[model samples]
Target: MNWTWFHKLGSPKWFFLWSKSYALPLFFLGSVALVVGLIWGLAFTPADYLQGNSFRIIYIHVPVAILAQSCYLGLGFSGLIFLIWQMKIAPIFIQSIAPIGAVMALIALVSGAVWGKPTWGTWWVWDARLTSVLVLFLLYMGIIGLKNALDDVALANKSVAVIGAVGLINLPIIKYSVIWWNTLHQGATFTLTEKPAMAAEMWIPLLISVIGMYCLVASLVLWRMQSIILEREHRSNWVKQEVMNNGF
Candidate 1:
């Protein structure tokens, strides 16, 4: 196969057309998986002996927490792409992903607080894990604010890229927060190197939820990126024609 096709990825029109074909299917599959996972987790999975039904929040909390951090990494990597090759889609991807990551971080923080309230006897803590996650959320907000604060798209992209890159310093902190400090937050319950501490009944649904959340994140990012592409390319003839034909 020729490598020439890779270069064409810079074209917004190509990505727009290609994404349209798969977006609906991805969205549908993500929805089905998320629904099945949530139902199984919330209703079918046995509760933890220690935490009881409150542990069920893990299905949401864990997935969102993982996605929140991973999405920031993604934005940072996209920024690298923008800085290196100057791909037109890179900044759009960063912009599209920021809000989603912020929302995921918020969900994780809230769910963690709720879970903490009953399990730890408190709603908030200054523990390293909690503090680092909060910092990640703030970084996401700063990126979003930078994007909106600038009127020039090019300038906004550069600014946010710099901010996102700087935020990478916190990613390692979030990952090692539990290990580095004695905190209320527990170590990873799931890992590839070791068997899950939880039983199969609980682990399976949690796994499904994690996978489903990833799918949902991908679908949302792609959809949002498409919208960004349309906005940026609105003046282009092809984009105008595509939008008109699609009844947009």
Candidate 2:
């Protein structure tokens, strides 16, 4: 198979054009998946025998929680790639993803708290998993802050990448906190090596929600990357022509 396209991603023009073609489709598809998953989970699936209606929140909670961690993982990886290859798009991608990841982290924390009030009878706690996830949110904020604090674009990218890579040390702590210590937070509901703890009726829709959330993240990042590219490439003839053509 041809691998030439991989190197072409280093070109802003190549990425910008391709992203415009795919981003909207991904955004629309994710919206459809989310709507279908929400309806299926909230209206059709049976409530947990124990938690009752509050369990419905999992449709939103699980996917965002997963996305929160996964986004950090992506950030960390993007950091590594930037530090090594110095790819122009690498830092832009990280910059594009950080705010979205932070929002997902916030949603996950709020949703977890909401679910907890019913299940664990508390709105907040200092449990390991909870604490680690909180730190994860802060890390996202730190990356965003670092990016803005620097005056030089190269320095900003380097700072953001370093902070992102360092903060990645928290991902494992968050994932394993349930097993490492006694916490009110539940263990894995879905695992690759084993079937989900919940019935298929419940989990299938949850899985769909996860897929939709991932698509939504991709769409957001792609759109954001385009904006960053245009700003960074403003002096280029391609960007000038594209901007003129778009009347922006």
Candidate 3:
């Protein structure tokens, strides 16, 4: 063990420089996968015998839904790192990611509703999974609001970290809501222990789409983190020199 690399990530300047190098490649790969997957799934793959073309929304809905929970998990993990190691980069990641997580949650909800309309015969439902997802969305909003409402930077970061840490409970509930109770929402699309129930035509593109979405989110998070790092470190000489030399 070498932990030196881990600690170096705590440095704002180091992480900013690292992210800049990787973000563009991530965005390019993600965009290509997303476009190809969406096109293949929507036009080429045979529609579900039961759901017909309506099932196409799954290409977008499932990935964002997964991202919603994953982003919060990242937030919570960052909170813990900040609380334990007092890593400066952790709180920056938290602040930079909260709004993006909220947007992901909102997209998941809206896409779910749109998918639900033709399938469930209504735009809304009080089903267990749906309600849990709604709660997850609210939790993200609450974290965002908490961060914005505080006037003190240190206090705000601590408060947001605590909230993000506590919010971990909701993720499991969101995950198991379908199985824990009778619900209109479907069960897991794919899992590690079990083969996907979907045909290869469906799940293959979906898997690609999921990978694409994850890459896209990573790229966006890196871009945002770089911006926030710049803003917070603006008074530092290194950052000033960076701005002057690079106009970034």
Q: Report the Cα RMSD per candidate.
A: 1.8, 1.8, 1.5
Ten contiguous residues with the weakest lDDT in model 1: 174-183
Q: 141-174 in candidate 2: lDDT tens per residue?
A: 8888888889998899898888777767656765
Q: TM-score of each candidate?
A: 0.93, 0.93, 0.95
Best by TM-score: 3
Q: TM-score of the candidate numbered 1?
A: 0.93
Per-residue accuracy of model 1 over 178-215 as CA lDDT, tens digit each: 44765565777778999888889888888888888888
How many clashing residue pairs, candidate 2? 0
lDDT of 3 by residue, 117-224 (tens): 999999987666567678888988898888889999999989888888777755676557644665565676769789888999899999899899999988999999
lDDT of each: 0.84, 0.85, 0.86
Candidate 3, backbone clash total? 0
Q: TM-score for model 3?
A: 0.95
Q: Model 1: number of clashes? A: 0
Q: In what order do the candidates fall by TM-score, top score first?
A: 3, 2, 1
Instruction: Please identify model 3 stretches exceeding 4 Å from their true place.
Output: 173-184
